[model samples]
Target chain A: MKFVGCIAILAALAGTALATEIPQADRRSGYSFMGPDSRAMQDDDTSNPGMLWVLDGETLWKRKAGTAGKACGDCHSDARVSMKGVAARYPTFDKALGKPVDLEGRINLCRSNHQQAPPLAYESRELLALTAYVAQQSRGMPIEVGNDPDLAPFVAKGHELFTRRQGQLNLACANCHDDNWDRKLAGAPITQGQPTGYPLYRLEWQSLGSLQRRLRACITGIRAQAYEYGSPELVELEAYLMSRARGMKLETPAVRP
Target chain B: MARPVLIALLATAAFAACGPAGAEGLLPYTVAGDAVPDSLTGTKGDATRGRALIVERSSTCILCHSGPFPEQAFQGDLAPNLSGSGSRWSEGQLRLRLVDASHFDPATIMPSYYRIDGLTRVGNAWRDKPILSAEQIEDIVAYLVTLRD
Candidate 1:
């Protein structure tokens, strides 16, 4: 009887130990991407060259696009209040289109629906600057999206994409940003993957890029199959990332080194 | 299947037992008090206290840096080796670094542990004070200076 009791006690101890050993689930489990440093550059022109885009955007807002006699300023008198905090809620689901939309997509929507001008192509300086200028309006607002039920499916899809492993590295976005953020891979600092600040001026790229463009670059870095511009996978990924940065304030036109 | 599951659970428990207390084993970096010097070369610091600070989960210093110390196993190799930092930098330069590494490398992800000025957008909770105290800085500097190799 004592032998049996001893065996049971040892088994109980083993079970208790195992239960405690489970790895803690990370909140950022699905996607892998570098996070911005706390002291990274901001939208101000003094910190980064990309801040020039905000100035250019101000000019573009005043200048008319297309043959139509309408400028962004014609409808919205002042971008400061009118467009402020607008960038923090992007990559949102649009009921009209029945899909997710990004800052560029929204810009095109405005141009086609309101201004009747041709939508700018991806990476166009005009679009980048305008987006930068517009995103800068919400410089200090915390990111908030997917609060509605309509966005749940898209957010879920994005989460799946973030955690799923891909590419030659056989690594998922979560593998680096979530699991190894604090641990460095090369010579760079590993930070929490937060997209609260974007349309950032990176010293390496020497220009501004949309969040979608940044995502594409990351895919390239890991040697994964690059998604086409504005693909659903990229859009979903953006939606998820914006949601992850829900409470973090936006710092559009952010500078990076 | 049950036996394998049981073995896996046992292994996991063993690993968890080795991790820092209250960290849930997720935080891999050593947390140090704000006493460590930011540079490798500097005045003598308290290695004994520095060791405690580095092992603390909140400081998060060991997240990206590696050193010759064996206790910190989760260090990432992204930054230069800090084992012999004392031989590389001076005390004043080390002071400047602990205050704000971003001033030196604009893209650095390291947080500013010292300077109370120039912060624009950090969360309200972290804004009022430097992460490390002046004495802690001195102690860390002194300790790092001991790392000759």
Candidate 2:
């Protein structure tokens, strides 16, 4: 009994010796990564490169397409009113398909099912333009997804994927983004990695991209075999990211380093 | 006959596929600043080469590590500082951490440079290959040992 007590004491001391801590009040956005110049670029309606895509998307919204000759505007007119709060609730579970679908998937679904137009390829210029435009409508609104009962399973799966370790590096998304966020890496601030401003312009890619693109970058960074666009793992992971950003103001077309 | 058992096995397999599972059974080693098995060419390590590799993006050591390198312009703060690291741990300890920090702490963010087992989703081009050669590990260890007050 004495020996066991001594061992337990030593174990407690060892735990104290490790300086790791799960910080309280760990709120930070990807905007924390940018400098004044980058922030200015994002806020400025004229200078922001994302606005250029937004403009193109606005044009696509009005232009008629598909064999049915229907524009996105024909059914859902004035996206400012129709698309409000829509982008904030993405990666939601699709009851019809029994899977989680992101804004991109919904966009493609509309094109195929309702618009009678060919689906734009993932990560394409056209797709990004449309996604950014739609997301911009929900700007300043808080993310409100994951409340539906059908989405609970995907949300739980997303939580598992977020916390579970992966790749050759044996890292979970939570390890860095959760544990070590508000820190710096290679001069760039490591925010909590919220996906609020996705389809937002990234200086690294020098182009507009999707949330899946950023996720792919992280997977590749860890030397993992990245899944192709629209993989189940990616969607589940996206669901978790959206959930994490719940109640946070959406910042579509936001800029990042 | 064993229908439930088969279902259980399949469930286990599916669950395992969902996350990265590092190798089973820890590699045994002595602690307290002992000698590491020298796999790098049995030659003196070059600290200069080691420093070069650590800062390079391809090495990716700087992604989550901040060493005693101010001139490099940027470093990560996720891991412990490498500055003055020699005084904190022995050469063997440092070597072990480089080879596989997971051996010490399973949840460590540090990658196992010399380990190939138990890793998931490795690219086809680099499957079965270690991230760093034994020589590179030696070089990094040498450079890290030079960090002092």
Candidate 3:
């Protein structure tokens, strides 16, 4: 059955190759500069409030956020060294719940167990920026998740969710993004499924957001019931994305259009 | 019944005439009048130049599309394949797309590469000129037309 599926996919690819003639100029794929809209909005100043959160995070790194009075710095210091490559391993499986967990969940975990602070709200600039800064520390690191034995089930679940069709359109994330990626749908250029960069600045959103937020947008585009912030489905999906981008270098806070 | 049939035939003829060719020619960027020609000749276009333009950090075309090209390991799968776009579309049609596809489809999110009236919302100093020059467009068109298999 798997061999049949593979043959079918190959036949479809061959048919498509014969059906459409791609332009040579358009075939040169890879990274490109931000479009006009994205270039204009980029904040060159590292001192911008968003960037300033890193300084605050630096403070919060040492100062306790919870009633326990135990600071993040108390447990983990030298973020440059300790947190190095940490962000790239996130959205991993949690043995306690037997499910995947994202960076936000991990942060909240620290808030409850260590610093004892209230969990930061979703879309909060402070939370987003702090997450951004921490993730930025792991820039250039390759994604490495789901290697543990207990993580296998969650990774498999994530892969299933990545390709499963859902929503009103009966379309999976792979449909428009993977299958029809080079075709002009209404006129917008389709991009490949790359999740190595997050906390990205988008022209359409006009702000920095997490990869989960972007996934939610895709879900909405297909007219599906959006998974709530911090939902299990989103965490699983993130795990799948991280796996797909296993070897790609992290480009946190990347600008996009 | 005869009068209605005559009207329908006339309407169909008018529509066919105004289809694509009747639309305005390619618009100019910096120079006055239409700097873009109806057809290109000479060196045609350098595929090497087109390749660099597609991958340049400022163009944003590669953000959505993917191809079999060697350098694009990070290519996305969200848009249509561009491996043989030249054969599918005419040079004039390609020119229109580069200028302003929104004229054909209002809801299109693609930006107008060239607009001489003014690019107010883009940037402070940014003008109506396209990121690539007319000659560059010719080069890209020439390169695109060559994709066969």
Candidate 4:
């Protein structure tokens, strides 16, 4: 009995030691990778193009839709008050689905369950607007998604995917984001794959995009078959990334070059 | 049973008519151990052209490799420096590495310039054709061999 207890203590210590993949002091937001022009754009909402989607989302929150004739505003009230720190804890475990769902998935769930509305398409204008609006409420709040004991298995799966090599190029997410961040790839900086900002504006895309879109682009970049949007794999990856970004400030609706 | 056999034979012939999958545009080459002993284009490559490709964005060589290219301001730090690759490897070894760097490290980020098969989700523009042509691969190999220091 004493030996078993000692083993348990050792295991807990190991878990604590392994908790941080990147040391807390070394963690840098993707915003730091941007130049002055892009940083200035994010700092001031008026110049930021992503604010357009956030504005549209504010309108849709009040406008009633679906068979239940409800607006997201009706139940939630003011997003600023109700949704504060909500986005920081997302890709939360869903009891009904017996898995986890991202912020977009959670919105779709609410739409289907409460409003009786058909789930919005992935990457749709409506979804992007609503997500941007909701996430924006949590801006500057530190992420806190790593503490759930139930999410341990899902987070483990996500870590496996992040470290595992895939596609024709056979490179893992860790190969660049973990091992070679802050280095230039043909003059382009490779930032740590932090999930602090999402539903964010990208100059390359010339529009707002979700994290899943970025993940798909990376997968395709490596010549690997990208997982379908909203797949369990993507949600798991998002959960893992959020866990990695725990304690980092949220920068939703961020502008990126 | 005879009809089933005939149908199977017909199906095989139909697939055979399309030529081997992913081998249509690729040039035939031999791999002996860790190297390709012959030039993929049957002739020597132009080192001058090869140097141009290494520094050019389209070739994507310098994207993951930093070398002795003095003119290029930004080069990558992902792979080993290209300065002494010639001293470290033989011509054939360099050729194989260019053809497929995964031959040495399976998890290498370097794309196979001359290989076409065993790849997935290749962009529409990159399908069927290898990332680099046989001549381009030979040129790169030629230039890589010159970096002796």
Candidate 5:
């Protein structure tokens, strides 16, 4: 299964090689930066702290909610069977809203639109758990967020945000993640800013967090005002990142330092 | 939608501008071309004190810069090494770089240690104040100038 995953990634890389600054041969997962202990934690579901949230998500999936009193399972049935490869193609264009909606956004939309429940609060434990649970079904599948023509403008905006310098420090996301990703910053190895393993556990955060949360932290680290959670800017950025990591294998509920 | 957010941001920035200045209010300094020839604090800074600040983790100097301090085992490699800053530039130039590195390169990741204006979304704890005070900038400049090799 892992070998098939690698070959699929390589094929995707080969197809998009000319378009990216990082060559296909040079592209690496953030997993390569982890030490042995972190790798062990990610490999073992029992020890991975993120699985706790995934477990909670499993419970939430079956529980009924809202005015309709309908559970997610009532419509989707078994998530493992229904949700397989679902996460790999997320932050997809929503025809109703005419914008991209991530995994969390889709879930909330399902609640309010179909189940008649209020949208889940961004960054809340309940939302995180549901997101983690959904994403986990696609674990080891290559991320396949397609080049939907509708997403191009938003992806460009996200690319602009990634490259444009901001904040008192006057640094861009590209400076650290693109130009100097291999170097160490105060004993911490800088990863290539891939969006593979999220809603993943972080030792620093001591909790599972979304990609938007991590993005806000980076913006703040450079002394910039972060966009609000669930903001369009953040969603666009997330779409761009998932597109950027198009070929990488998903490692949802992965552990990280 | 963006306009309201922009308005709110501008208002916040304006509010921060009206907040208390640095530790004892921002001391004015002269920028002569590419350098601030005058020390931020009128008095000369102590190199010993400056060295202590650079070596300390809280100051964030060594966080992105590896320096001549052998005692500190973990230094960053994100920026240029700080072993020969003295030999490369004048004391005045060092002062300006420490004060606002973006003056040299607009996109530099280095923080403006003594600049308070034109910043966005500064936390309450850091608002209205520069990252480093005049004395601290002077002290850091003093230490940087001593790094001949």
Candidate 6:
């Protein structure tokens, strides 16, 4: 049922996040954003479309790579145990690279350094499979990222961007997630825009997607120029979102509206 | 940026209003039962044509808004029903709501149908132009004004 119906009007006015105090309710996970049916879809792994990607990722995990022709399984060996908590701990601070790296970034690093394979293009089918597969291991684990002192600067930058409003719409991420997390927009419920369910399946897409894709959609929804994939701003925003959702459970391959 | 430069940059960009003032500068634009007086430029609006535009993919009001029609499929739930909007808002208020609803609610998902400034990620083809033209806004407004029960 629509909140504002055919006869019952008086649609609730959108409020400024700046004026409103951030409610503790805003800390809710993305699961709150979904409808009952979607939650059911997520509850049953067999029905979840993201499982399709996970299955492929499982295959790729064991498949060999270039030059050395090493599969991800060769080095990591038994993702069920070895890859445990890996997704939860990203975007990790890379001491040598001197920046935080997301799950996908770490996967690429492993490919070039160990497998000697060229990096996969962002959002490629194989990349999505591998990411969904890898992230599946950490499913149900609490996100434990953005804790390192080395990641402080990047996390701070993410905060800046989250609050910064821009575009013709003049909206910031915080406007929805912080000010109206429990409020309904149009008919859709708003969540804190948490990153806990990324590399997740969205029924809207009918396919698996990376966190960057979701971020891009949000930017476009606000009518702002989306940062390019792998851009510093997007990466920093990812780190910040992960930090924001520090204690939320990772629902990789999550089903969403 | 390093601390000093970062602070300087934030100072300049943060406090600045997202969009620049129109020809009127920073004064809030007026909303009422009529078209924006000076900016309207006297283009006559036709309700007949406005009716066509509402469902047209170009104007796309129906993409998110449902009623005020018998012929078109009762569609989307993203916005309020337009069936009795004329009874709810004054003609001037309707005009202003379409021109730029954001002025009232900063976080409204409703697009500024007739605003162009402070926009990013706009396609190259439609850069610097509002979604609906001045006459089109008047046309839609004309049509909606007649919908009063």
Leading candidate by DockQ = 2
- Model 3 C-alpha lDDT per residue in residues A24-51, reported as the tens digit of each score: 2432111343355444433443522234
Native contacts recovered, each model: 0.16, 0.66, 0.01, 0.53, 0.49, 0.28
lDDT of 4 at A139: 97
**Per-residue error (Å), model 1, residue A214:** 1.5
Candidate 2 DockQ, CA atoms: 0.33
> Residue A37's C-alpha lDDT in candidate 3?
45
Residue A176 Cα positional deviation in candidate 4, in Å, after optimal superposition: 0.4
- What would the per-residue lDDT of candidate 4 be over residues A1-257, giving only the tens digit for each residue? 99999778876753443233677799999999999999999999999999999999999999898999999999999999999999999989988888989999999999999999999998999999999999999999999998998887999999988876666565678878887789888778999999889989999999999999999998887767789999999999999999999999999999888
Candidate 6 wrong stretches, greater than 4 Å: A1-16, A19-26, A182-186, B1-35, B38-41, B51-89, B101-111, B120-125, B147-149
The pairs that clash in candidate 5 are none
Q: What is the TM-score of each predicted model, taking all chains together?
A: 0.56, 0.84, 0.54, 0.81, 0.84, 0.77
Misplaced by over 4 Å in model 2 are A1-25, B1-41
Chain A only: list TM-scores of all candidates. 0.82, 0.89, 0.79, 0.92, 0.91, 0.90
Residue lDDT tens for model 6, A78-150: 9999988889888888999998888888889999999999999889999999999999899999998767999
Q: Which one is best on lDDT?
A: 4
Please state the Cα-based DockQ of model 3 relative to the true two-chain complex.
Answer: 0.03
Candidate 5 at B41: error in angstroms?
2.3
lDDT of 2 by residue, B1-149 (tens): 58657645654554365312453332222333334544234445788999998998878799878877878877887778788988887777778788777666555677888777877778665677677776788898888888886
Tens digits of per-residue lDDT, candidate 6, B7-47, equal: 44543453253323542222233343344432242445788
DockQ of 6: 0.18
lDDT of 4 by residue, B107-135 (tens): 45677787778765555556677778889
Residue by residue across B18-116, what tens digits does model 1's lDDT show? 423442312112213422223222234577887667545455555556777687656767556778777887655555566557556433445556544
Model 1 has an lDDT value of 0.65
Winner on TM-score (1 vs 3):
1
**Cα lDDT, model 3, residue B117:** 38
